[model samples]
Target: MTNVLILGAHGQIARLATSQLLQETDHHLRLFLRQPERLTITDQAREEVVDGDVLDSAALTKAMAGIDVVYANLGNAKIEAQAKSVVAAMTKAGVKRLIWISTLGIYDEVPGAFGQWNHQMLDGGYLETYAAAAKVIEQSGLAYTIIRPAWLSNADTVSYELTQKGEPFKGTEVSRKSIADLVVKLINDPQQHIGESLGVNQPGTDGDKPSFY
Candidate 1:
């Protein structure tokens, strides 16, 4: 069984991925979050919740012990700093595989009017920091697959498509469940999309903005 470290485990997508991992795979999970008490353990035998900040390199390094894969579902204005910490901790611990959850437009890959709307929505600080963070991961020399998801929804269905880094992003939005499904798929095959950045969106969701918006 592979040991997986999930940083920011309290987040919605992380929680979904955690549950799916437990139910679908026999991998052991180390759920790292600031408020550990907020997470309810579904399988104590395969899940260990750790209270620590990703920015704390020492704590991250400690949690990296025996970890085979690092799936980071973290965000915020200090994302660049967090990326640095994760890279450093993983490097020090000798772990190489990383699955990072980033957002669309990080590379301005979105096309047409939707791209402009996306910029209007996320340009200020969010996109800037996430792009910087992705840069850190790409240059870290780790076996990493960066997932840049389109606008997220709470839809229960798992329907999505992927576009490579240079390709214009497809569709308008994707469900959180879809992203979680992709994460589990990568964890099961850690080498699948190494050194590539993917843009994920729901099939037929092409529009100027998400249907919900």
Candidate 2:
């Protein structure tokens, strides 16, 4: 079975992906997070839990050892440093595959007024760091697929669209379950979208802003 390391294991998207992985594949899971007790499932026949910060390379190295794939579902703010740490640890562990969860608008991929709003709202803060993290993964020489999801909701649908890198990012929102569906697809078939940074959104949700915003 493929051994996967999931950093930021307690994050909402990561948690959903974990559930999808558990239900859909027999892959072994290595869950790493700051608070071990926060994760809903601490022990399963095929799961291992490790407690530590994602910015800690030593901890990441230990967590990454013998891992076949790394799923980094980190948050913004310190994401650039976290990306660096994750890449370093993966290199140290000789792990070559990574699935990084980033947001749209970092590459100026978003279009129209939504793009304008996105830039004015996030460019200096989360967008800046998100771009930096994306650069790290692209330069790491690892087989990577960066997923840039639009504003996420806690919806349960699995339907979505993918705007391949270089395409104008379409739509303004996607369900968390859709992101998990795509992530699990990539985990099950790593050869599909290598070196691509994909923008994921629900097919008909394009707008100037997310519905809730």
Candidate 3:
């Protein structure tokens, strides 16, 4: 069974992905979170939780040991530093695959009215930080898949179409569940999405704008 490390394990999307992974795959889960006490999972059969800040490389390396794939659901702010730490830890631990979650408008990939609003809402240091993190992953010489979802929602179900880099954002909003599902799929089939940065959103819906606005 594949051994996967999940960063920010207590976050909503990460929690959903953890649940799905436990149900759908035989993979072993290593959960890296700042606050491990917040996670309330009854099943302890195939899961290990490590409490540590994302910026702590030694801690991350300790948690990442023997891990084959890493799912990064870290938030913004010091995301660039966190990504650097993760890359360093993964390299030291020989973990070659990473599925990282970024957001729309990081590279101005979204277009038209929604794109404009996205820029307005997510602009400034955070966007730059995410972009820097993306660049680090792109140049890390490791197999990586960057999943950038549009404005996120707490919808209950999973359903969305993913567009690769250079395509317009599919829609203004995608359920967190959908993003989680996609992350899980990528984890299960790492070879298909390696070195690709994808944009995900609910499909076939027009005239709806980015949820940030």
Candidate 4:
């Protein structure tokens, strides 16, 4: 069982991923979040809840100590700083593997219908922000897997396909559960995705067309 640390544990994707990890896997989890009370975890004995913000380097350093891997599902805003702190903390703690959640079009790789819509929804360097973060991770000397999911959906069901580097994004929307599952998969076997950025999305879907009127 891997000793995994999940940053941004209160976020939607993080919550779902935690649920799956708890129910399906034997791995131990340390949930790092700003508000521990808001977490819906039932197995108190199985999870170590660290109430702190990612921006707090000291707290993060403390939380990351002695962990095997880190799964980051941080939001886009302030991602650069947050990632930097995580890297520093992990480095200090001697944790190496990092699984980071990003969005499609971070490299203008979004393809099909979804890519077009994502471009419109996320304007003004939203793509650039994540791309920059990925760039940092790539160069941080850490074994990392960057997952860029298509426009996220709250649907209860999840189905997805994985696209590796150089492949254009395909598909439409992805359930938060699906994203969570992917994270778990990585945690289960880090060797499969070390140092690679992959894309996930619903198949046969396209971007939401904009109205010119």
Candidate 5:
């Protein structure tokens, strides 16, 4: 079984992916988060929770031992720093594969009025830091697939589509479950979409803003 390291395991999407992985795959998981007590272990046999910050390179490196894939669902204003730490830790630990969760508009790939709306909403700090973070991952020379998901919702559905880096981003929003589903798919076959940044959104969700907004 592959050993998977999930940074920011307390996040909503990470939690969903964790449950799905346990139910569907034989992979062993190392769930790394700052607040370990917040996460409830579903399967102790296949899951191990580590209390650590992604910014702590030593702690991150320690958690990477025997890890086959690193799925980082981390974010915040310090995202750029976190990316650098993850890259450094993974490099030191000899881990190659990474699935990075990012947000849409980091590349300004959204089109039309929606594009303007996205900029208005995210241009200040969120988009800037995330773009910088994605740059760090791309330049790190690791086999990585960066997932740039559209506006997120708590919807229970798992329907979504993808657009490549240069393509105009499609739709307005996608469910957390959909993003989780994509993460599990990549973990199952780490060879797919390596070195690519994908924009994910629900099909037919095209609009000026997310429906919830």
Candidate 6:
């Protein structure tokens, strides 16, 4: 059975992916949540919870043990540092596959008015940090798939589109469910998108900004 380690286990996308994995597969999981008490999961079944900072190398090493794929569904400003820590731990653990969640502006891939507004809102801040982290993962020599989702929504829908790296990022929003669906797909087929950075969004949702904004 493939063992998967999910960092930032408390994140929305991570939670959704975890739920789907629990329901659809019997693979073993190691969930890393900074606040263990915040995790409401009562069933341990084939999963183990690790409570600590994602930047804690010791803790990360322990979590990565015997894991085949690493899903880093993290957010926050220190994301670059966390990515570095994960890379170091994965190297030590000799794991190859890494699916890291990033955002659209990292590559300035979002075009037109939206891109301008996104940069004005995020550029030098979140985008810079996310891009740095992506650089780390891309240079880590690991089999990695960096997933960059457009403005996220909590909509209870699964429809979405994919734009490979180099393609203009499309759409203004994507559902959290859609993101999790992609996560589940990559987990089931870890080799399907090795070395690819994908942009996911809802078809026809493109505009200057997300509807909620």
Please give, for residues 39-64, the per-residue lDDT of candidate 4 as tens digits: 87688777989999999999999998
Error of 1 at 205 (Å): 0.5
Query: Residue-wise lDDT of candidate 5 within 1-213, one digit each (tens)?
Result: 889999999999999999999999899999999979999997999999999999988999999999999999999999999999999999999999999999999998999999999999999899999999999999999999999999999998999999999999999999999999999999999999999999999999998999999
- List runs of model 6 lying over 4 Å from the truth: none
Error of 1 at 76 (Å): 0.3
Q: Backbone collision count in every prediction?
A: 0, 0, 0, 4, 0, 0
Alpha-carbon runs more than 4 Å astray in model 1:
none
State which candidate, 1 or 4, has the greater lDDT: 1
Q: After superposition, how far is residue 188 of candidate 5 from its true place, in Å?
A: 0.2
How displaced is residue 96 in candidate 5, in Å? Answer: 0.3
Q: Which is the better candidate, 1 or 2, if ranked by TM-score?
A: 1
Candidate 2 total steric clashes: 0
CA-lDDT, candidates in order: 0.96, 0.90, 0.86, 0.84, 0.96, 0.91
TM agreement with the true structure for every prediction: 0.99, 0.97, 0.95, 0.92, 0.99, 0.97
Query: lDDT tens digits, residues 1-213, model 6?
Result: 679999988899999999999888878888888777777775587879898888889988888888999999987889889889989999998999999999997888899999998898887678999999999999999999999999999999999999998899999899999999999999998888899999999999989999999
Cα displacement (angstroms), candidate 5, residue 117, comes to: 0.6
- From the highest lDDT down, the ranking of the candidates is 5, 1, 6, 2, 3, 4
